[model samples]
Target: MVALKEALARNGGLWIGCAPEQREAPSNELVMHQRPDFDIGLFELEPPLYRDFYLGYSNSVLWPALHGRVDLIDVKPRYAKAYRDVGRRLARLVAGAVNDDDVIWVHDYQMIPLAHELKALGVKCRIGFFLHIPMPDLQTFKAIPEWQDLARCLSDYDLLGFQTRRDLSHMINIFRNTLRGELRANGTMGISGREVALGSFPISIDVAGFRELAASGADKVSPPPLPRLIGVDRLDYSKGLPQRLAGYEAFLETHPQYRSRVSLLQIAPPTRDDVDAYKAIRSELESLSGHINGRFGTVDWTPVQYIHRALPRTELAVLYRLSRVGLVTPLFDGMNLVAKEFVAAQDERDPGVLVLSQFAGAAEEMPEALIINPHDPHDIAQAIKTALDMPLSERMKRHSALYAHLESHNVTRWSTAFLKQLTSVERIGPDGVAPLPGSTPWSRTA
Candidate 1:
């Protein structure tokens, strides 16, 4: 959200999305918020339609399938129709607002079919799409009922961006093996007379902004009482929260002397609570945390601190700076920005060690971190022990390497590279001369 908002503020475009406070209304009016640099348009949808489209299809069906949990996908017969209906409605709204030459950049899994719907309405504009989640393997992706339809919808885009090379390769294999698409020499896939370019663009945080947050106001808040290890993530099934808690339990059981000296602080805010899977995970985490605390807590010390709510970013920065280790072990992630943020928030003199998951996309860039297989509680426990006992010199060296990478591949660079590539896609006119994709040629002058 921050990256796209900054991009719109700089490049001058209208940001359109669903309204935050949706009510049961029949009118398709777009509520407008006019900013100095850009405009935001929020459209309304009926309550039932919104429920089926977002909660039912997007979260319950596509979310699990994309995360390689096809067994958990609960797709009703009406879900496919609801998804298509929502896309058609949004396309009509967008076609009415956009110009003929505007470059449309769609984002995430929810809007995969928007470009196809837009083109169906006779809108001849170049549209690009970026998928933020991990693209599943061939058999996993093929398990989805509407795989063919989804692949067809994806081919309508001029370009497709993924978070990692593995994800990009998986997508390319799907196109070549299943769809019989021809891979050209220029790295574009030709299908149904349309050429689509695919690339990996790992998203990043605003490094300078986060560093400012970390550096400012150190005296306002007191430091933690114990040697803390932190894990901050949304309360989702893919985050591996239960396994993380179990790993902490294993660490304490194996290393008895460090029980009172160190603690694991896991901060996970609720997400998609209305879904059954989310509710089950939340219940499981609560039970596991309770069990760990009951088994390890003394009169003066608690081994696990489970916070189920959100905290301010400034407070989080302070926590990250003061902790002894950052435990980010997701089973699979597109790119966990919290790992990068932890690196950015560290003190150079005495930095915290990072225990990351090999399955996360960030592991590709941050090889200096102590990478562990998240599926193994023993591996996570051993890595945590290594991080907690590492010398100050080794910690500083690892943090230095990680922080330098974050500085070079910050969020601004990510957005600039994506938009540059999106605008540079070759589109020939009637006279064989190519122009810029968007109305205003993309420039960095702003």
Candidate 2:
């Protein structure tokens, strides 16, 4: 939200997002924090529509498919209808307040169809979209029942943004091969005569914010007797909690000596309890954690501390600082900010090593980290070993690099870069510094 505020500092405006509550709630910044610039609108959905649109289409279908888990997709006609209806309602809600020059930037897969609906109503404002998840492979994307329509709807935007070049390329292929949209330079695409600029704008966290949080007055929970490895994630299947536990288990199995010298602290806060998959994953993780702890844990020391709740930012920061290794091994992620936050929270003199998943978006930015293949338990175990055994000089070097990159491409920069691209699409030339082409002219001026 700070990034959004800073990006729109010159022309302050509000952002809109769907909130699943009893009723529309006031902005937290307005009510709690007493910050005036906190202009976020959260429109509450009808119970039935929320079930269909959010729990059904957005999470059930799009969330899994976009993450390349098409097997989890459960499509229904009503879900799509609900999604479209929500978009229309959202447009109507803000249409009266939106000015002619307002740069409308809809976010994530939920708003994929929004721009198209707005265009249908002849709202000629400059609209942009950013997908916060992976674009999925062509095959996986086709699993969505209204894939073509969804692609066309997204194309209605003046610009589209993904988190990585790989994702951007996959999306480009989708437009060129599936939708038959014209491809152009600089990620600009020509789809049905509309020139849409699409590119990778990797999302990042607020580096200073995390560091400040870490420095805040939060008492350190006395560390366990052994050195710690910390993993914090929502209890989501895609986070590879099972695989991560297995990796640690394998590490202990292979190296019996470390049973007394090291421990794993996994903090998984629950989310999406409405979905059966979430409940199942939680049970499975609990079992796996118990198995690992039982097998290796002594009466004096538990090998794994499995927490099923969220902590305050300050608490998490202290934990990160105390950790000897930061274990973030998501099977697939848009951009795991945990990896960056761990780096930011480290003490410069003796920083903890990051054992990151190669499948994560952070892997691209964190080459110095001990990257591992999440699918291979051996690789993860080995990476953990490497991180733990890494020399102080090497740890400092890796953390320094990681911290610098996080500071450079922080959330503010990310928002500014994407918004700049979104607003400057017309300035692009025939080739280079632009994106793939479209048949339709995006604007009359172009």
Candidate 3:
């Protein structure tokens, strides 16, 4: 969202999204903010529509299924219709603002079908779509009753972006299966007899700004009494919070000597509380945290310091700096930015260890960090022990490598690459230029 705002400042556009506090009626309104470079539109939905569109299909069906949990598929006809209805409603609001010359870039699953709707309404501009989350594996995606329709809608875009090569490959394979399109060797597919460019541009944080925040020493929170291992994620099932707590318990059990000397500080703010799955995950996580704390707590110390709230970046940076280890072991993720942010905020003089998940997209980028299976508590526990026991020289080496990569692959580079590609797509217009594909070239502009 920060990068989106910055891009809007550079090249103006409107951002329409859902924000309940901005509720005037069922219609979207332009948000007049301090920054005049861009416009923001917020719409409030009716209760049943909200329940189905957001909490129902988007979360219960698309989200879990996309993240490789097909059993969680809760597809209802109303939910699917609600999804389409919301897309059409959003498209109606967007239609008033867009023109033939403007580039229409849609984002994520909720807005997947918006481009097709816009095209149907005769908005003849180049449309691009980027999925921020991981694409589902072929079989898991097939579980969705409307998978074929969704895949067909995806092919309507000129270009598609994924966070990792794996995700792109998955999409291409799925397209071959569902769209019956021939997949080319260079990651293009013959979708409706035209080539659609597929590419991966891993997302990143503001590396320099985060490092400066680390340097500022502002908003520093009081570190835990023990040598802390930190886990920062939104409270969600895919984050593997329950497994992490179990791993922490296992770590305490297996390594009794470090029981009082070490602790896990987890900062997980609630997300999608309207959804029952999210609520269930929260309950399971809280139960696990309580059980672990009860099992391994002293009069003056606790084994886990779990904060169910968000923190300012300044404070988070300071916390990242102070911790001895970063535990970013999500069960599934497109790209875990917290892993990079932790590395970026580390003190090189006495850097911390990062225990990352092999399943996370960031794992592909940073091989130096200790990687483990997020599903296995034993594996997570073992990785924790390894991180806890890793030498200073090794820690410094890993941190330096991860930091160097983040410095080059920061968020600015990501946004620039996507937009530049979106603009440079092979449109049948006068300026029929194309961007260098495969991966985005790293940019170092201020």
Candidate 4:
């Protein structure tokens, strides 16, 4: 959402389509609400349509599939129809809102068929799509059975943005093998007469802003003096929260010397509470945290400080600054921004170590982090100990390298790169270059 907002702010003349419930009280509901930077309009769709179609099928099904969780995909006929209906509605809304000069930037899997719908409606704006999550390989993608249709639908967009080279490669491979599309040199593929450009533009954090927050004392909220190790994430299934607690327990058992000397401050804000999986994950995390604290906590100091709420940005920065180790071990993620935030918020004088998950997208860029396999409790335990015992020289070296990377390529840089590529693509002309045929718009299909 931040990325989309930033793009719109830069481009100007933006109409944001969201659920009606979200727009009722826009100030509190919007993520980056009070921006004076650009002319932005918010348009809300009916809640039932958004929830049943967009959130249900798009997020619950396609989101998991893209992130390599084929087991969680639920593709019902009704859900598929709902998905298509929502797309059509979105396209109609966009057609009414947009002008000739406006550039349509579609976000995430929720609106994959949106571009096609807009095209079918004869709205000739240059459209671009970005998938924030990892695009799974052919085998995982094909499990959907409706994969070809979806892929064909996506070809309606002039440019398709992915998080990494791996993601772009996956998409290209799928198009060539499954759909028999002609692959291009610059990560693009031609399918059903439409030319779609595939490219990697990694998501990032506001490094300088985070650094300022860490340095500032204005929003500091000091907790009771405790040797804190931090894990900041949304309480979601993919975050590996239960396994994180188990690893912490194992660490205490194996390295009894550091028992009361350290404590984990797990700042997990609850998300998607309406979803069964998210609710179950929250319950499991709470239970696991309770068990661990029960086993090792004393009256004076609890072994784990579990805070199930989101903190203000500055307060989180302060927490990040105070911590000695930032443990970010997600089972799977596109680009865990928390890892970057933790790195950015560290004190240069006495920098904290970041024990990151190998599977996280940030790990690929910031290899200096103490990478751990979240699936292995033993490995996580060992990584924790290693991070704690790491020498100042080594910590400084890793932190410096990671910080340099973050400073060089921040979120602003990422957004600019994607939008630049998106705008550079030429639309198919009327006479010689025809609009891609045989590609069904999402709204029509729905």
Candidates sorted by TM-score, descending order? 1, 3, 4, 2
TM-score of each: 0.94, 0.91, 0.92, 0.91
| Candidate 4 whole-model C-alpha lDDT, 0 to 1 | 0.79
lDDT of 3 by residue, 357-398 (tens): 998999989999999988889998999899888888988888
Compared with the true structure, what per-residue lDDT tens digits does model 4 show for residues 1-446? Answer: 55566556666655465634633323322222345766444545456655767667876788777777777776767677878876776677778777866778888887888887787788878888988877888998888756877877777788888887778888888878756778877656776565678788888877898799887852456643756799999887778888888899999999999988899999899876776677878889888889998998888878988999998887888888888899998888878889999999988878899999988888889899999999999999999999889989998999999999999998889888887888887554451124444444333334
Candidate 3 or 2, higher TM-score: 3
Candidate 1 regions with alpha-carbon error over 4 angstroms: 428-446
Write down the lDDT of every candidate, Cα atoms only: 0.84, 0.80, 0.81, 0.79
Better of 1 and 4 by lDDT: 1
Off by over 4 Å in 3: 22-25, 28-34, 218-224, 428-446
- Candidate 4 runs further than 4 Å off: 20-35, 218-224, 426-446
Q: How accurate is candidate 2 locally (lDDT)?
A: 0.80
- Reference-based TM-score, model 1: 0.94
> Which whole-number lDDT from 0 to 100 does residue 339 have in model 4?
93
Q: Is candidate 2 or candidate 3 better by lDDT?
A: 3
Please report the TM-score between candidate 3 and the true structure.
0.92
Q: What would the TM-score be for candidate 2 when compared with the true structure?
A: 0.91
